[model samples]
Target: MDRALELAARGPAHGPNPRVGCVILAPATPGIPGRTVLGEGWHRGAGTPHAEVAALADARARGHDTRGATAVVTLEPCHHTGRTGPCTRALLDAGITDVVHALADPGVTSGGGADHLRAHGVHVTAGPRSAAALDLVHTWHHAVTTGRPWITLKTATSLDGRVAASDGTSQWITGPQARAHAHAIRAQVDAIAVTTGTALADDPALTARTPTGTLAPHQPLRVVIGHRDLPADHRLLHDGPPPLHLRTHDVGDVLAALHHHEIRHLLVEGGPALAGALLAADVVDELHAYIAPVLLGDGPPAIPPYGITTLATAPRWHTTTTHRLGDDILLIARRTATHPDPDTEEA
Candidate 1:
């Protein structure tokens, strides 16, 4: 299960599909009494073979006997076919007799996989490192459950919590390494969004670039959301694909519109009002903040007032990771769960 989880993380950071991995263990034999690894694979992205299928193919290509093998998968085998055939069918075809998975897929279109496998007489075991597996695809899971893109608000601020100085000169708040890391993050998600005020003022090109300043192969859709028009010569309008100009200040409307366009993961590069609006609406899922060592006393706060007059109403998050980037520290936190998981409850 730990190996499967590690493989799952090798998939794209964020996309329309959830990250998944699979490992095939051969049945006990005379020479190898314990389980021996036959093959291993991880899902790449959309329009590609799923994890189970990939692992099975790997075993087949290596001339390994897959008959009666057990499949260890990070996610439950999907039963419904979309771009490819069902993974459950693939496993059954490969002569897999036993199956173990970390988490059941929550998607309505491609769910109920464990039951299908059991109904077909395959021995099944579940809940091995389930929490770790869920965390692997939590953003995609949240997006699937809520029917909207999951957001991660990225901000660079001083130790005192200010984004820019009083003069509005906000360039280079974080060091070079932190900015490079931020660009790497932008390369993973489907879209990077900001408000019109930010668009007009910063005129950010918003392209995911390499450390050498070259454009990365994967670039996010640059988006500006607000009820204001940007100038024609702005780099955002001409840099990459045409910007997704969402002409509205309504946070719900903005998210719904982005969802309509099939944006599964959204990275918000903010000024203040836009981030605060999302915070007030409680739509933001993750917070990615880069804290610089310097403290600017007379600068704008990274996030302005939202509506937490009392301490109890304040937004709380669970810190997922922290890493040092040059002189800055990147802190990532995620929203606390509001409801219990049915699978966990069942377990």
Candidate 2:
């Protein structure tokens, strides 16, 4: 399973599909304590060959007999055919004797793969190293379970929690290292989002540029919200991928539109007005904040007041990670709990 996890880590970092790994073990040799590993493979992304089929093909190409071999995989072998054929059929065709899977597929279109394999006389064991598999697909699972994209709200602020100086001179708040880290986050998500206020003030290109000022190949879709017209020459309008202008104040509508575009994860990098609205709607899943060691006594807050009347009324977040980027500290947090049902909530 550890090998499977390692292989799964090789999958793409920016996509809606879950990362999955597979290893095929041939019949044990006389002196070997365990079966010999014949092949290994991991799923790259959606519309690609699944892990099981890849591993089976690799083993066959090596002239390894796959009959009665054991297949260890990170995710439950898929049963239905969508972008690719069912993995269960692949395993059966390869004459797999036993199958060990880490996590079950909870997707509406792809669950029950284990049951189908079991009914077909394959020995299927579930939940070995399940935590690792679950971790790899957390964002994808959240996006699939809820009809919304997983939002990661990123803000760079001063030590006093101000986003900018009093006079609105906010360029280069963080150092070069921190800015690079922010661009890395931008590169990982399916889309980078902002509000009308930010579009008018910053005129950001919203492209995931590298340290050398070159654009990354996997540029996220640029998303601008609110009913406002952008200048024709704006970089976001003509720089990289075609920008998505959502002329709506409704957060749900914005997310629904993104979901329809197959955007599983989004990075929200906008002003306090947009951040406050997303927080109030309880739609944000993660918060990524970068705090420089400088103090801005009086300036725009990183996040506007959320109308919390008392301490108990305030939203709670649990720290997931913290680190330093140059002189700035990066903090990642997740809400204690998501609202039971967010579809009925107002934006």
Candidate 3:
């Protein structure tokens, strides 16, 4: 399962297809007790060997024989041909007898990889950490299957769910730890998107800032969504490390453009209206909310006015995980499969 999580972590960055991670487990040697993780491999970048092939190479280099090793991966091995050879064939060539995957591939070109492996005489098991693993690459899977970009709504707010002061003065509401964590999330996405209100009000740069010596460099595309024409002096419009741009209104148009650019993962940062609009459009696939410990009783609300006339019209989502980012609480959610039955009360 850890291997699958690792693969999911590689998503939003791996191009063309979401990256996957693989771990090969073999029997312990004389001095070793039980099974040992003989090798680990991750999709390097575009135009590189797939995860399973890379794992095979790593195992061979480590002097670990794969006569009957078990392969654990985040997604089912690809059965169809692609930039590289079929991962199923690679596992068979490596003499791997068993395979465990978190989830089956959902791509039209690559679905049923598990069934193909089973037919090839490899023991296969699915549904181990499948949901969590799928969450990592949800955007990628959604794009492949539905022809749209994966959208993640990101927000940082006070413990009381305020994003700014009553007068709309919001600058660094969260502590350094929470802010830094937000940057890390930004670095993982293919694009960092913000609304026009946020741009006009906050004038945020929306770029990921890493600590002085972190090896992984952040270079996500900067996107601003709204109808307002941004001034040339806007900080985000200038040439810099990561590319920047302004996307016009019409969520569907913006999504189509993103898909054309091969951007499967998106991070939506906002001042309320933006988030509310995406939620209202029923286009948001995921949510990442960072709640700080402090509160501002008369500050800006976490969500902008959704403009829904009644409670029945409100959008409903499912909470997936809640974790701590320093003193702040992080809440992750996914849009429910269907709009809530109006008669059902929200928990």
Candidate that scores best on TM-score: 2
The order by descending TM-score is: 2, 1, 3
Off by over 4 Å in 3: 1-19, 25-38, 63-70, 80-83, 92-98, 118-125, 157-168, 211-216, 227-233, 239-247, 289-304, 318-333, 337-347
- The whole-model C-alpha lDDT of candidate 3 against the native structure comes to 0.78
The TM-score of candidate 3 is 0.74
C-alpha TM-scores of all predictions: 0.89, 0.93, 0.74
Query: Which pairs, if any, clash in model 2?
Result: none
Residue 249 CA displacement from its true place in model 1, Å: 2.3
Off by over 4 Å in 2: 29-32, 337-347
- CA-lDDT, candidates in order: 0.90, 0.88, 0.78
Model 3, span 244-299: residue lDDT tens: 45457777888888887878888888757778877778888888988888778987
lDDT of 1 by residue, 288-317 (tens): 999999989987898999998975557678
**Full ranking by lDDT:** 1, 2, 3
lDDT of 2 at 177: 89
Assess the local accuracy of residue 3 in candidate 2 as a C-alpha lDDT between 0 and 100. Answer: 96
Q: Please, what are the lDDT tens digits per residue for candidate 2 over residues 263-340?
A: 988999997888998998989899999999998898899899867777556778888999899999899999985433
